[model samples]
Target chain A: MCGIVGLFLKKPELRPQLGAHLQTMLVGMTDRGPDSAGIAVYHRPVEANQCKLTTFHANPDYPWRKLGGQLAEALNAEVDVEIKANHAVITVGAAEGSARAWITRSHPEVRIMGYGQLMEVYKDMGLPADVARRYSLEGMEGSHAIGHTRMATESAVTTEHSHPFTAAPDMCLVHNGSLSNHNNLRKWLRRRGLEFETDNDSEVAARYFAYRLGEGATLAEALEAGLRDLDGFYTFTMGTRDGFAVLRDGIACKPAVLAETDDWVAMASEFRSLANLPGVEKANIWEPEPAVVYTWSLQEAA
Target chain B: MNTIDLSKTPVRELNQRLHDLTPDTNERLWRITNLKGEHALAVGLTVPIEVEIDGHVGYYCAGMNKEAKVVITGHCGVGVAENIMSGEVRVKGNASQAAAASGHGGLVVIEGDASARCGISMKGVDIVVGGSVGHMSAFMGQSGSLVVCGDAGQSLGDSIYEARLYVQGSVESLGSDCIEKEMTPHHLAKLERLLSRAGIEADPRRFRRYGSARRLYSFHVDQAEQY
Candidate 1:
């Protein structure tokens, strides 16, 4: 079981407090998932051409500056890196493909949490409050963010095993329930050359999206296909560069509530997590239908 | 009136104070403040006392209650008043999943909407929802009445036992062994009383009654694959 929360700000004025609001929502669902927590913040893009890669290291004092310098030298472009706790978000002036390949070959000890134009994900093995505090979540600013507090069911409780699994650029997925057929699905994807970091079923889901996106499917199309191909009781909250989406399995045994106002759209495991949101009492609150992919994008408002 | 500031005091102390009270206690009208969506507020009380929660509450806010009148001013998390034995539990705002689940006695009123599985596996209770309820509500309910003023989500009253379901609005779908039954005058009367008791304003004539068809009471060998 896990608790998932996603916030998409409709008003740009609320963007500065995105992390603060999301942190409160994440902490409210602490009872639902008590083991560890994860968050993916859609912060501003450092540069239009820059590829933002957030990486995690076992040691808190990992040589991020040295790694950043080497990466900059390798690409012959400037790299701006910021270290937060055990995670670092590096903005590089290089092609994402070559940079990812270089990191995979050279930095075997470090795990890339996510990579995108405007997204940075941070997750660790601890309580949601502690995790949020360790990252100084409230002070961060973004347009949208998604968080997850996990209660381990299948895999061991490790930092890599935590949620907000990133599979593609500007894409992250957090799951609330288990999949009965992840083993077979994992093998199916692995045969097709999808690399997996952990045995967790959620990783399979993340890779599924990455594989689909790699094959040139939009988020909506991939979600529709996922509804058909993926089997089990699951509620997924996915984050992209500009927006977020929520999906429930056919059975929809897992709990998911969505509340929206003119200023923001919020989704959480329960209403308590959303009750503190601005104008939530006046929001259009409802439960998401089964087998339906509900998406909201920044381009639509524009 | 006895006002307990939950913000200043812990849940254990507040509940301890309630547990120590008796029927003869003069301070029965207690007001709890700063709930901040906390859990298990005023649970397991035997005295017929009144509890007014000034704010939202968390999981199992009134679980396994007995002969207490608890009211929440804001929304509630999962399983509010779950397995209540008697008395009244009311939510001024919305309720999460499984509100009033497995209640044996008394009434539960939600002034706002309730999420999925409201009153699931209820042995006997009277649940009144002022607004809509989510999917799979009243699943496998044994006895009592579930009165929904608004629409019900998918698969309402699935595998229900003897409990009656009265939905004023749309039902997305019906569950196995649960079928829409005729709303008799007796049902209308009972529903009228339940609605009035819960302070819900709804016309009883517009409600649709649903109950068990007893088709799955004795499992059949042919339907084994279906199960």
Candidate 2:
């Protein structure tokens, strides 16, 4: 079991405030999952934004820093580059919107996990408040964001297993519950040459959604594809560069709640998490029907 | 008695207030009304506080209770008094299935009827239902006593261990490997003690006992065909 939350603000100026409210919502749902926590925020770029691509390797013998430096040198010929750990946050002059695609073509196995003005993904095994403070989550800002608090049952408890797992640029997902047909889906995806880092079923789901989106399908269309094809219990919220979308499994073995207003849309695993939101009204709160796809768009923001 | 009203207070705060109270410190009484099927009501209590809920609860009401006494003024949903380690839970109205299910130790007295699979997979808790129980009552019963003052439903005591079943009325049907047993003086004594604890004045002599025949414990090729 795990908890996922997301918020899409209609007004770009309210992005910082929405981030603060999402932090409170995540803290309220800390009990559902106490393992690890991560967040992804989508911010509109000004002119050119830096993108960080971090990859976790199983082999400790590999020279991670040297590899990052070499990638930076190659990317710097086209733009300015800075390296940190196993990551290289590149700020390109020409590749404004194409940073994600360029990185994908250059490094096939390595994913452009995050892309935006500010995208930080950190994992820690503890209470949500403790983990958030440790990761400095309060300083995060964006127009829309998605987060996950993991309770590791099916997979190993590690940073590699922590979510908001990004399969491509500007596409990240946080999921709850297990996929019953994960093994079958894994074999099919592997046959299509899709690489998987962890054995988690959530990764497979992310890949499935990414595959659909890559085929020129809209976010809603890709989510509908998941509802038709994916089996078993799951409730997920995917964060994109513009907005976020939420989906629930057919039987709804897990729980999820959605609350929306004129200015903001918020979601969590329980209503208690959204109880104290700044502008939340009691009547606007409702639970998502089982197997139904519900989406909130920041594009409608004033 | 000290009375606390739960009309406007949040359930979490109410539970916290209940948890902080002590038995000898004060005789605490609470009137929880307008409860719209909330989960974990009055859960994980150790003090000797008495709580009276005015309406139905969703799940795990009085769960993991110890020392405190709880009385539901109205009907209860699933897993009421579930996994009760000690103390007593008296339901004034009909209880849903799995009442006192998986309870390790304690006493549950249902003044009204209990639904299907009552005390299913009971560990050691004693349950006394004044009205008839539904089908599969005490299915996979491990140990403890389930005394149904009314009729027992079908498949009663299926796959049962050492737990005993005493019913005053007729049994709809027996589960596999279960058969009626003689209610001797020893059984009468046990029933009397349990009935007295539940504050029921019914005579133990009129009731009959049912238990596992122990024929299904070992495998036999001849019995395999019968199954």
Candidate 3:
């Protein structure tokens, strides 16, 4: 079982309060999942041609400035870095693939959490409140964000197992229920050469969506394929650069509630997480139907 | 009236306060405000008191209740009164999956539709859905009566045993081993009582009764395809 919360600000003015609102909502779900917490915020968008990567280092006091300078020297491009706790956001003025490959080949101790234009992820093994505090989530700003608080059923209670699994650029996913066929799916994905970071089921689901998306499938198409391929009781919340989506399994055993207002759109495993959002009373609150693809996006064109 | 605001109060504290209440407590009415869909709220309440929740609630809002009456003025998430032993839990709005799953005794009423498996694995409880119900409701119901004032989704009362099902509207399809039985006078009388108790005013004659065919009770080689 886990707690998942997401918010997409319909109004640009709410960007400043995005983290504050998300912090309260995530903290409200402390009891539902007490072990670990994770959050992915799509903050200030870099230029369309540039990308940013959020990385995690095992050593908390690792010299990030030196790494930033080394990355700049190797890539021959200016890099901007911001260190938060054991994680750091390195914004480079280049394509995502080359920098990703450079980091993977160079820094063996550093693991990439996410890579995208605006997404920055922070997750760790601790209480939601504590993790949020460590990330200074209240001060962060974004147009949208997705958060998760995990209660491990099969995987180990480690930071790596914490959710908001991001296997694609500007894409993150969170899940509430365990997958029934993850072990087999893991082997299949591995055979297809999709690398996995942990023995977590939600990661596979995210990677599956990422793979489908990478193959040029739209978010809706990829999610529909997930429904056809994946076998489990899952209530998934996914975030992309310009899109947000929610889906449930055929049986829809796991709980998910959605509320949309003029100002923002929110989703949670329960209502408690959404209650604290502004203008909630007037929001059109309802439960997402089973086996339906509910998606919202800023890219209204096409 | 004892009011606990969930905005400032943790769910554990609220449940602990409800758990500490005795039948003879001085306070008779407890108002829980700003629930904001918190899970396990008022869970395991044994007192014979009444709790009125102002807003929405999360999973298992009144789960495993006993004697206490918990009313939700807003919609509820999954398993509103799951594993309910005894008590009256009322939802003013729709309920999510398995609204009264595995309830043993007492009555659970949902003013709005409930999702799939509303009474899955139920045991001796009365569930009244003011609106429609989703697919596979009462999947493994052992005993009790499920009254749906509106239409029922697919596989109503699948693999049911002994429990009686009453649907005022159309049933999408019957489950395996479950058949629409003739609404005898005795069953109609029971349906009337249930409808009246649930504050539903539909005519009892419009309703149909469904129950087990008793064929699946004992395994037979000829009925192997049914499994």
* Per-prediction tally of clashes: 0, 0, 2
The B-chain TM-score of model 3 reads 0.94
TM-score of chain A, cand. 3 = 0.96
lDDT of 3 by residue, B1-227 (tens): 99999879988988888888788998879999877666788889898999998887778889998999989988888888998888899998888888889999888999888888889999988999998898899988999999998999889999898788999999989999999899999998988887777776788898888999888845467877877
Worst lDDT run of 10 residues, candidate 2 chain A, spans A53-62
| Model 3 agreement with the true structure over A1-302: per-residue lDDT tens digits | 89899998888888899999999989977887899999999988899878999998868998888988998999898899999999999999889998899999988788898998989999888899999999899998888899999887787888888889999999999899989999999898899999988888899999999999999999999999999899999999999999789999988878788988888999988787888888886677778878899998876522
Retained true contacts (fraction), each candidate: 0.17, 0.00, 0.60
After superposing candidate 3, which stretches have Cα over 4 Å from the reference? A299-302, B1-30, B36-50, B62-69, B82-87, B168-173, B183-193, B201-208, B218-227
Tell me how far the alpha carbon of residue B164 in candidate 2 is from the true structure, in angstroms, after superposition.
34
**RMSD of candidate 3 to the true fold?**
3.9
**TM-score for predicted model 3 compared with the true structure:** 0.87
State residue A301's C-alpha deviation in candidate 1, in Å.
Answer: 5.0
Model 1 agreement with the true structure over A1-302: per-residue lDDT tens digits = 78999999989898889989999999988888889999999987867777989999989999999999999998898898999999998889887777788888889999999997888899998899999999999998988899999888777889999999999888999999998889999999989988888888898998998798789988889999999889998999999877789999977688888888889999998766886788775576666767889999999855
Give the poorly placed runs of model 2, Cα more than 4 Å off: A44-69, A76-90, A93-112, A116-120, B1-227
User: Model 1, B205: alpha-carbon shift in Å?
Assistant: 1.6
TM-score for each of the candidates: 0.89, 0.57, 0.87
Query: Taking the tens digit of each residue's C-alpha lDDT, what string does model 2 give over A130-202?
Result: 7677545577677777788888887777767888887766788999988989899989889988888788889
For candidate 1, list the clashing residue pairs, or say none: none
